[model samples]
Target: MGKALIAGVMRWQNTLDLTMSPGNVVAKPLEHVIAANDANKFIAYNNIPPDIPKIKTKSNSKANKNKC
Candidate 1:
């Protein structure tokens, strides 16, 4: 019975160690991708490119246009 109690305590300690370990939590790679996208959006909103032409859509052209 003493050996069984020690074994149970060791198992509980191992479980606690695993849960408390700092390396157990990992960030997903997509988090970096989303951060990069946010940074790009911030830069784009702050600085508008002058070379790109502005598109103006006519209300009546929807019925005749084949190319989008």
Candidate 2:
């Protein structure tokens, strides 16, 4: 795992136990960086270049009007 993937204290105290979501701290550390993406966000926006025109539909044609 990359340095960014590992953060905070190596030891666990009550303060380090952030977030109520339960998880294991004993996970084996990886030696290499891993690649990941937001699957839902990727599928929704499709990584399309912003300059490309989108097909305007009834529901989305005015989606950007409020930006102005």
lDDT top scorer = 1
Where does model 2 exceed 4 Å of error? 1-42, 45-53, 63-68
What are the per-residue Cα lDDT tens digits for candidate 2 across 1-68? Answer: 21323346665344332223235242222111121433323222554544468776675554546545
CA shift of 10, model 1, Å: 45
- Residue 1 of model 2 has an lDDT of 22
Candidate 2's TM-score reads 0.20
lDDT of each: 0.38, 0.37
Counting clashing residue pairs in each candidate, in order, gives: 0, 1
**Native-to-model Cα distance after best TM-score fit, residue 29 in candidate 1, in Å:** 3.3
What value does the lDDT take at residue 61 in candidate 2?
Answer: 57
Cα shift from native, residue 55, model 1 (Å): 2.5
